[model samples]
Target: MISRLLLFGATGDLAGRFLLPALARLSADGRVPDGLQVVGSAHQDWDDRTFRSHVATRLQQHAGDVPIEARDALISRLRYRAVDLEAAGSVAAAVGAFDDGGDAVDRPAVAVYLALPPVLFPAVLGALGGADLPVGSRIAVEKPFGTDLTSAVALNELLTRVTGGVEEAAFRVDHFLGMPKVQALLDRHAPGRPLTPVWNSASIAQVDVLWEETLGLGGRADFYDRTGAVRDVMQNHMLQVLTLVAMEPPARQTEGELHAAKLELLRSVRVCSAAEVPFRTRRARYAAGTLAEPGATGGRAVPGYSDEDGVDPARGTETYAELLLELDTPRWTGTRFVLRTGKALGTARKGVALHFRTAAPACDPGDAERVAADRLWIELDAPLESRQPGVQVTAPGERAAYGQVLTDLLSGGSRLSVSGEEAEQAWRIVDPVLQAWARNAVPLLEYPAGGAGPPPLEQTAGSARG
Candidate 1:
């Protein structure tokens, strides 16, 4: 049982909404051990009192909305420390409060929740190490583990140097990976599933990840510029979604083993061969566009990438990217992993759609080949199946029910939740793709933001290169 929850960024976006309520729920449910202490750490020059006050405000904004009285009780457990990232040994010193009385925690079970930028990870890990957290301490890490493969490898190497090679203790969260349907896909649709037959080359034709955001980079423009949709979407989140949908099951269902097997699958992913990579990259920079928010007008003047400060306006930095990807794994060797992501879209969505090839005519010589096929859409937004008009139909045609995996994973930390190893492997596979973009002036198809990605994607059979 974790008694002390060390929050690295008390005032950050994630800590305010996600962590606060999550911890409040944990506290309310008694998952947190007694004498529970919440340590808020950041470079915010707030002293103990100011930091505690900040915590109270956060509670009001988050946990205090419903339980005002209980908010005080939970707020009482929170302590703010003015810890500097540059100051050595500050982490050890900041976390010392939980150990006010010797052995108060019995065993050091601290969850070091990191809400800082990805770059600060190594330094923070070092500070926490100096804190000398006892065994059973778990560290939570956010996405973009690395902007690319080399960066990811370097980060993992740095982590190993600090922890001296501890495995599975790191909670690398993609948030999307924590969904219940993702777990169900792993458990039910694995290699031996009855549905496996349809997902194979002879039956299934394509799979795609649709992750579109309705809002542009309001203040996060700088961060968004450096790591476009490639690192943000394809390299990490969507690839994790892709692998789960495409990878062959391991001999057994263990996290480490499964991830290692996934690494093998990704390694087989051809790195350089241009044809294998394809010329289907579509990227867009949003101009001032109308947001679909409740009160938006014809064009409410939302800022685009170029409008943001501290960014090169000439750079073709993509706010939207779409790639018709192909995997080397035998299960989905020929099928396309159609990926699409963009900022300033009309709607916010993140999910995968499985488009199955329609079955061939059985015995009727008169039956013509079908153009549009059936699809299984797993979505985060509104859940509905796609349907078309039928002849003489009394009611609308049957539509498939889109499922929500987010709600399931949020309530329970299922294993299908993207593991750190899987995140790293994803970076490993896409490293070549990024390098290809840099080394060669590959043509980039331009699509306006706030629209469907660069026209529709097209792929040719047996055209893949080594």
Candidate 2:
């Protein structure tokens, strides 16, 4: 089927940095079908020529070294229209122009991609419902689906209204799931493997899903201030990773099977109670400090979170957040799943680490020395470098995360997309933590900009119960 992608917020930073560049790479690789058209829409009043020029510039800047022929091929299929996405008639008018005289059966399948803010999703979806698009047309939404559980449920309701209750047609894009290494990790969890055998509370000690960035909030101060580290990362990306690790093996690898398994896993998630929130969660804002390297001469100095240009000190936003969660299932009851993310750290570390429990000591007295638990690391930022002690799985020719996501959407695949239920459940899991932070029940600790996060939480005997 011919696919036409309608990108809302076409002129925004996300489109320029990720969506358009990904499309360009797809065009270069000949993954985008010949008949597929890309139509960009925004509030900017630009004609087709001007819009094409803008796309060309962004592609050159972000895509990097696209062949001339491939670049032109993608640019040729590009079209643009100016529309106030929230207005009643705006979406209908834009879609109406693309309508062919032929019957709906003969026309291309339209996919409306909402790249706008989460706040505008309801209006855009409502406008699309009024536009009377094809019955089978798809809808793709960006991340941070909603601010909280209530809003997420409302967003899902809005999506159902537009898609006529067809949940599969709605695609909520979470770019982290599209990473090849993440897919590799899922493959390892299939039936009958070394890791699969120990994938339970009995064998595993703890699971850490960490995403740390050395760079501070560069120019995204306004958005970052409102959406601290938790909402921006833990709610969607980190939770999705947790589900993948803790979920039961799907009957098959199909999108439906995987999604169902993930939903079931999320349903079993147990968040800390109000009293336990303080001990189970930690939030910290970075303070101005120098990043001291072990061997390097002088460390790099950085500004604190409060020192950032657009940040508000009074808002008490945290640049770093850590939460301890548990799956209330028999397989993972005692296993602590720690989700951590921070900015302006000493180093950049992005991956999922599964730390296995050390076996019982041998009878020999010489073997009394404690042996560290085996660790399985999935290094996301580094390409083709996922490794255990002796085993390493290299994912060759891994495509860009956004590029893979675009490919999935264009081909009518939802495996990498977040379902409506998943989005809501993620917010539900973190709702209590958010409320606790709001009430100042959990103290917002301060850490040096380039230090190793806040002090570790005291672990009680037996296991670290959060």
Candidate 3:
């Protein structure tokens, strides 16, 4: 167990909304040891008392459900320091203040959680490069790992060097995978399961991993304009969902086995070529319109995507992105995986849907059998109202997605964390599409908010710029 946690960016939005709340829940459950210490470092100049007060306010706002005593217990463990991320010495000094025990064998483990922005990863890792992190120490990093494949590779290499070539010490966190539903999906396809046998090309025809939302960018224009939809959703979150749905069942549920299976599946994803890009991908931005309320006729008006606050009209950044990907492995040779995400959609539908091949109906003398294709929907956002049975799973009561992530991180497990190679392979699969869209090789369509997204690929492919 980790005896101490060094939480970077403790005053940031992520820490207040997710990390602190998660830790508070664990504290409530008595999973947090009384002797455990938490060190919070950020640019804020607040002292320990002031930081605890701030934490109290944030916990009330975001984790009101957690008992007051638990919240207080967590706050009691927190100490604050103002550390300069850009300066390696400053970071090293702040972290170095927390001393490990006498020897490596008796030392209590210390874990570092980087809740800061991706741009600060290199600097923080560089600082830790010189800091004396005790043996068995771990580092948990947030996502948007890199802007592209090259950057991801470099970041991985830097992390490896920082940890003295121990890849397991660096945990690349993807909170989406920490959701109980996603974890259940992984367990659902374990060896000997009924679903495992039919989860392949022979039975399943196509898999759709979609993340559609009715909410527009909520004051994140500075980040959204640069990231757009593809990088924001598809490249990491959606691809991870795809791997969980389609990867071959691991020999066992061990972390190494699961990691190997996911990595192999990601490696099998065929990267789109220049020629295939046009027809295989689609991009669009939402136009000005009213967004309908859930299960109601009334709605609120929304501005067009490009007119949103802080967006660059000239960047041609897409608010909606779609990609049709294929795998070269025999298990999925003929199957397709469609990944899509959009903002300000008519409805919020986030989940993986598996479409199974239509089975031939029995011959009847006078009646003709009309059999529709079977679909198993693993609903994430809401329950579906389809004739076919759908599966909806939520995080085990009171445990949010980040809670599960922290559980794995603190326990020194990598099953829920993304590996370095997995991150690079995801970029490789989507890089071609991003490049094609950048060069204007693919046409950008306009779809109204509160309506269906851009037209199908076949309808727009002919109009793609040459």
Q: Pick the candidate with the highest lDDT.
A: 3
Candidates 2 and 3 compared: the better one by lDDT is: 3
Q: What is the lDDT of residue 278 in candidate 1?
A: 51
Note each model's CA RMSD in angstroms.
7.9, 6.0, 5.9
Tens digit per residue, CA lDDT, model 1, 73-189: 677777887778756578777767566454524556666777788878878877776776755566767777877767777777766655557654465666655444444555435
Superior candidate under lDDT, 1 versus 3: 3
Alpha-carbon deviation at 90 in model 3, angstroms = 1.5
TM-score, per-candidate, Cα-based: 0.81, 0.89, 0.89
Which regions in candidate 2 have their CA more than 4 angstroms from the true location?
Answer: 102-106, 291-300, 359-373, 383-399, 458-466
Which regions of candidate 3 fall more than 4 Å away from where they truly are? 100-107, 293-297, 359-373, 381-399, 458-466
The local distance difference test score of model 1 is 0.61
How far does residue 428 in candidate 3 sit from its true spot (Å)?
A: 0.8
What would the per-residue lDDT of candidate 2 be over residues 110-174, giving only the tens digit for each residue?
88888887778888889998887865688999888888999899888988988889887898999
Please tell me which model should have the higher lDDT, number 1 or number 2.
2
Q: Give the C-alpha miss distance for residue 16 in model 2, angstroms.
A: 1.2
Can you list the residue pairs that collide in candidate 3? none
Error of 3 at 130 (Å): 1.2
Each candidate's number of clashing pairs is: 0, 0, 0
